[model samples]
Target: MPLWLLLMLWRGSVAQVLSYKLKLQKSMTVQEGLCVHVPCEFSYPWLSFISAYVSWFQKGADVNQDPPVATNKPNQKLHERTQGRFFIRGDPQTGNCSLDITEVHMGDSGTYFFHLGTYSYLDTMFSLNVTALTHTPHIIIPGTLESGHPRNLTCSVPWACERSTPPIFSWTSAALTSLGPRTHLSSVLTLTPRPQDHGTNLTCQVYFPAAGVMVERTVQLNVTYAPQNTAIRIFQGSRTALGTLQNTSSVFILEGQALQLLCVTDSNPPAELSWFRGSPTWKATPICRSPILDVSQAGAVEEGDLICQAQNLLGSQHISLHLSVVYPLQLLSPSCSWEGEGLRCNCSSRAQRAPTLRWRLGEELLEGNHSNASWTVTSSLVGPWANSSLSLSGPLGSGLRLSCEAQNAQGKQSAAVLLLPDKPEPRTSGVIEAVAGAGTMALLSLCLCLIFRVKTGRKKTVQPVQSMDMSPAGSSGSGAYQHQSWTDIPAAPPAPAEARPISEEEQELHYALLRFPKPKYQEQEDIHTEYSEIKTHK
Candidate 1:
């Protein structure tokens, strides 16, 4: 072993080691069901070997017995796990050994080395880290979503390799959707949103068959819409809500009652609610700028329309209510009067609306123009007032009752009177009593005259005193007497009495005239006088 021989052997070994050099990426990361590219370059000492090939083999394996994971050599065998998914790019003659892998699985995660034909091998190796798929589907929305309008949406996985198996695509949403075009990388869907579909979720899910894994993406829908289903709810005072009116309606409210009206609508964006006094148009000013309209007095509300309008940026809607205020019934006093032999009675009543009138005979109720043997009834209507009259045609019964009744939708009223058959008429009874008393007084005056004549005859000779007769011109009857001033009358001397017995006719005609002094009491302002004359036959 001389120094010169040792030097020659060391130089040849150094040159061979420098020629078999490899430039490759040290490590690469790939997701399951995706592809990865490993760039590599190398230099070999065999420059005369044309039409050469390259292969890749898993590290820590026997290169002489085990097949390569990927190869470009003709008639060369490959590993079953990476036969179709792994390939070596570029020719070995150009010293380019780039490796490409599609649909990489967890089992493919290992270190691999480059092999140059059967005699050359690169010591430099690269590691592949195959992790679970974390790539989610991408959802692309081209434009804004409007309610009731159709639009297209796309979901795609652009990172996936073209050589990989096509993934299964599915969609989940609450909106109306239909299938559109589809490809190995992307799927298209036609979506029609509604007002109710606003703020809802839409999901695009994809299934990788090669790796048996699923990936998904979710997006919230923002749908714009106009007002719809506009309505008004009515509430009386503090009570619960009553009817709901979607369009025009008529409502009858009692006078002076409180009311509440609420307007409501459905839309994507919230709508503005307002209340109007009458039928509203687009330019009408609103009375209230809120959803609720409170009326303190129903009677004060005019007989017209009340409108509730709901408006938004997209469109508007409204509802109307016609208000009618009603009042209670009122009745006037009834009257009854005598019309010849029949009794007539009248009754009248008035109200906000026209009222009806009727009659009650004792316990029976009668209406319209009723005619019977005993009584008759007639009715008439004039504006708000209703009138009725009753006539009794036959003789009245003892303690009989008659009534006039008036009624309307609000209330009813009646007036009654009692009649007695035995009672006399007021004017005739007074006249009869006065005449009887006057007759009695005349008889008493005659008797007093006879007494006076007997006394005078016994005391003195029967002498006749000639007295001036002041009787009126009609003086043939004994009852006739002369009229003198009440203040200056003198006492009369007794006339001579006749000896013969008085005849019955003369006695009937006989009368006495008496004068009484004025009463001393200042309280008495009037005096009553009766005159009768005494007549004698000799």
Candidate 2:
């Protein structure tokens, strides 16, 4: 052997190996109830010398048992489990071997290995791949309905195995023979549900030859709902009477008159009949063959609307009846001494027409009663309306119970009120007298102030003669008196003092001769003169 030759052969071997790699032409996936074909191709020049045996095996360590292969002679040991499920085809000249699988299941998902036999009598690994197949189909049903009406339901499988030849569909139920064509990949069943169908089980089954297995789903149906068409009827009057009709046709009645209200209704399964004056004030009564509600005449039955309702599984219906009652107009019953002075009472009548009112004390009708009473009347335009009242305040401490009676063409109604004496309010005369006395004192003080002002004014108007002189000390007091007397002399007569005319110098000397009392006294007099001068300046 030569080194160059050895290297060349190694190179040649590497190139050939790379060029002859195996390849699969087509890959396939099949549903659980279907079939698939995996086609493969490969090239190897040296292996062409001897016809290679084509073998296929699930990729596992125990491949010898489940080998999927093509051989001229059948291999009994390997054909045991895989006999019907797998088949293979190959062409020796082209070096191609492809395998087909039927009735694929979830367990069949794995790599498949292809092997080729060589002249050396050894099988060589050619190609490997993964095969995916669907598992068992799951069916689901969402809901069901019952009673009132029919409803449609749907049945569905998780996946469709379209590859199965002549896909099979079927349903099973005890209520019906096998549902053939109606069953599909996704089937819908519609029918009016009855109580009997509830809890019934339904099954949808599909079969496939390729898979050699059946896939099925089951569901239980539930049906439930309410009942229907409730109504009512009224009897006792000429208007559609159910029992004996009354002679008179009147919706109104006077106080103390006998009255009855009848209520009736028709229902399936016979509903319980109940009587109610107002809402929630219900009383259960025995239902007769001809169910009717009857109420006795009572003072409390003034204007009121009565409602009747029928109820069953299906639904409910309600109807209303209006009642009018009239009674005598009366003052409120005088409350007892313990009850207080608020004495009030009511009068009502169910007469068909408006009634007249009369109030009386004992047996005699009183004129004062009419004067003390206030009246209000109300009229309704619609079919049955009621008028009610609340009364307040009346005479107290009258031992008698005042009666008010009302009469109509049909009958008369009356209501009485008892009077209870109330303690009179305490007298406030002393307080009023105190307030008046205080006012008189204030007025007297004001009058005194006015009288003082008028006296002062009169004194100012009447000038009085000064008996004593307010003159300088040491000076002749008679001089001031004489000066005043001279000034007081009337203008019609000339004073004797003024007739004696004195020279200017003599007048000055005379003033000099008239000396002030003392230096301190003169100083004080000068200060007074200075002050007067300041006042004049200002």
Instruction: Give one digit per residue, the lDDT tens place, for model 2 in 1-538.
Output: 9999999999998987665656674335555555667676767667657556666665553444454433433553454445666666667467766666655666666555665553211233323233444344454444536454645555555465333344466666644232212343555555565545657887766676555666776767665533223233334335454333222222544556544445444444345444444452335442332345554453554457555555555444455555556544332221112224443333333334455455555666632123335322222212221122223345543465465565556565555553323322111123332454467456543432221111322323222222323354345532232222111211233223212333334321100011133322222333211111000000
Model 1 TM: 0.66
TM-score of each: 0.66, 0.32
lDDT of 1 by residue, 271-348 (tens): 999888877877889999999888778774455688888888888888888877666677766666678888787778
Tell me, by TM-score, which candidate is best: 1
The clash count for each model shown is 3, 21
Error (Å) of candidate 2 at residue 475 is 99
**lDDT scores for all predictions?**
0.76, 0.45
- Model 1 spans > 4 angstroms off: 47-51, 118-123, 235-254, 302-304, 323-538
